[model samples]
Target: MSLLDASMNAIHLGFAGLWVGSVVFLTVAVLPLARDGAFDAAPLETVTSRLQWISRISALALFASGGHLAGTRYTVDSLTGSAPGYLVLTMLALWFLLALLVELGSKRLVGGFADRKVRQPAREARPYFLAASLVGVLLFLDAGLLSVPTAIPF
Candidate 1:
């Protein structure tokens, strides 16, 4: 790979790792800490706020870097230049999926945090976050794998 490709890889990998790390922390540590009742409402709010901040930043980084990378590959007829093209496309699709879910779910979470009546069950948040994160990780992995330049005949 050229210098540009290497830098792009680093950007993509860094954002991917950050995004996954944020989700794992929130799901494994933050939520349990909040729900175990070890902390008061103020503390729980503090924890989720931090998690959300990290998540938003990481997501934006991933989105921005990913969009830049995708933009480089964009053609008049298509969105990807990577081979195993279907997989690459699927990977990009997950970014969109995560954006939508975070928009919807986070809004709901915020609404719930603001008012208990709309709050989804505490247990649900971890799973939802994990699912979204998992999707992201899969896409990241696929991009790393398929970005190689070898072309194999079927």
Candidate 2:
């Protein structure tokens, strides 16, 4: 009865893993190097832009398909009956909001970094990047831990 049967499940899992992996790599590995100024802004910005683009695309696909699946199966009662589903939904909303900020920062003005004359442009990047990584970690863990079948039959 689950429309997200095996093939759909596999696809969803793959997308989730890729998105989660990107965030983990950025958080656990890349951030420290950036903090140490191991690379210049130009190159760092390029990498961040590409990765975020990829992550956003994958997230869009995941959310779209997941929404369809949910609509086809779970009623409002079923949805509200569990802690995991609600938690995942809330976490995803937070992640999406954070992503919007990152997209604006990178696209509109590089967080005003394009205007190199400003003293605070580079500093602004640090906080945005940090928030992106932490939110990614939080949502990734929440989704994984919540998505599994954990019903205890008594």
lDDT of 1 by residue, 113-154 (tens): 555322243455656766766776776677666666364231
lDDT of each: 0.61, 0.61
Model 2 agreement with the true structure over 1-154: per-residue lDDT tens digits: 4555655666766876776676556556765665565656676667677767877887787777667666665677767776655764665586576566566444532554354322244344556656766776676666656666574221
lDDT of 1 at 97: 75
Check candidate 2 and list the clashing pairs. Answer: none
Q: State candidate 1's TM-score.
A: 0.68
Segments in model 2 whose C-alpha atoms lie over 4 Å from true places: 1-4, 104-122, 149-154
What's the lDDT for candidate 1? 0.61
Candidate 2 global lDDT: 0.61
Model 2 scores worst on lDDT over the 10 consecutive residues at 113-122
